[model samples]
Target: MTRCRYCNRPLRSARSIALGYGPTCRARALAEARAKVIAQHKPTTIERAQELIEDGGIVPLRGNRVWRVVSTDGSTTHKTAGQVHAWTAGLRGRHTCYHRVAAQLVALAA
Candidate 1:
């Protein structure tokens, strides 16, 4: 007897047998896949954002006060505005903002 790949139950319906999983299992699988896609589109961290900028993967949007960054994983995540949080570079407690980091990156390249 053919078994459902997901629920591991004996396949009863011809459609379920052909698909290898029951309707409920199929629905669960689809929901999980969608959730994974959504999770992959979450906001990126400052370090990841810097790497994206250096690799030319994204351009910071010009804003009045702060900058914005999107997910580096190539997903359509919403643009996350800069939090003005300072990041330490090898030094404890010492930190700077994205604007300063951008300038530093440019200076390093030039």
Candidate 2:
């Protein structure tokens, strides 16, 4: 007798025997797989930007409507417009980065 992979119950049908899972267990396993995929998605850029602010990586330049943001790795610095909330070091041509997002958050809080 073939056994279900999930519940370990005997499989009576030919299709179920080949698939290794009974219909109910197969559906449950698929749903669990989908949920795991959703939960494992990569974190968004905004979260990194938020971390920068929390780490005191953002600073206001004196006598100007500009802010300075440090890179996450501390290898570079970028300037952002205080009012417009745009940064220089962007990923591709998106014209936005964690620095930009951090600037926007600071602007909002002020």
Candidate 3:
């Protein structure tokens, strides 16, 4: 007898046997797989930070730990330190901005 991939329950139906998952487990696995795919395609904060770094938008301030980050639109700029905490709307809470992320990447490279 075949067993479910997720719950380890017996798979009696031909479809379940072919899929190796019971009906409930198959639905759960499919949902999980869809969520994973969506997460992979979504633009994350770290990816945005990396884009800022790659675009030469981050510059150190006066040999200090502070950095200047330009917006992608080139209409605004923000100053942040390597350890500064910023509020991100997308994150809905306090988080580090691209300036700080660029600084951390530079530090790691050095």
Best candidate, lDDT: 2
Worst 10 residues of 2 by lDDT: 82-91
Residues 2-109 of candidate 1: C-alpha lDDT, one tens digit per residue? 997877889899899887879898878667754543344323334544565676643445532333433335554333223342333413424433333433333233
Q: Model 2: clashing residue pairs?
A: none
lDDT of 3 by residue, 40-105 (tens): 433575577678878888887757566778865889887765566333541443544555665665
Order of candidate numbers by TM-score, starting with the best? 2, 3, 1
What C-alpha lDDT do the candidate models reach, one value each? 0.49, 0.68, 0.65
Each candidate structure's TM-score, on Cα atoms with residue i matched to residue i, is: 0.37, 0.48, 0.47
- Give model 3's TM-score versus the native structure: 0.47
Off by more than 4 A, model 3: 1-43, 85-93
TM-score head-to-head 1 vs 3, winner: 3
**Cα deviation in Å at residue 65, candidate 2?**
3.6
Q: Count clashing residue pairs per candidate.
A: 0, 0, 0
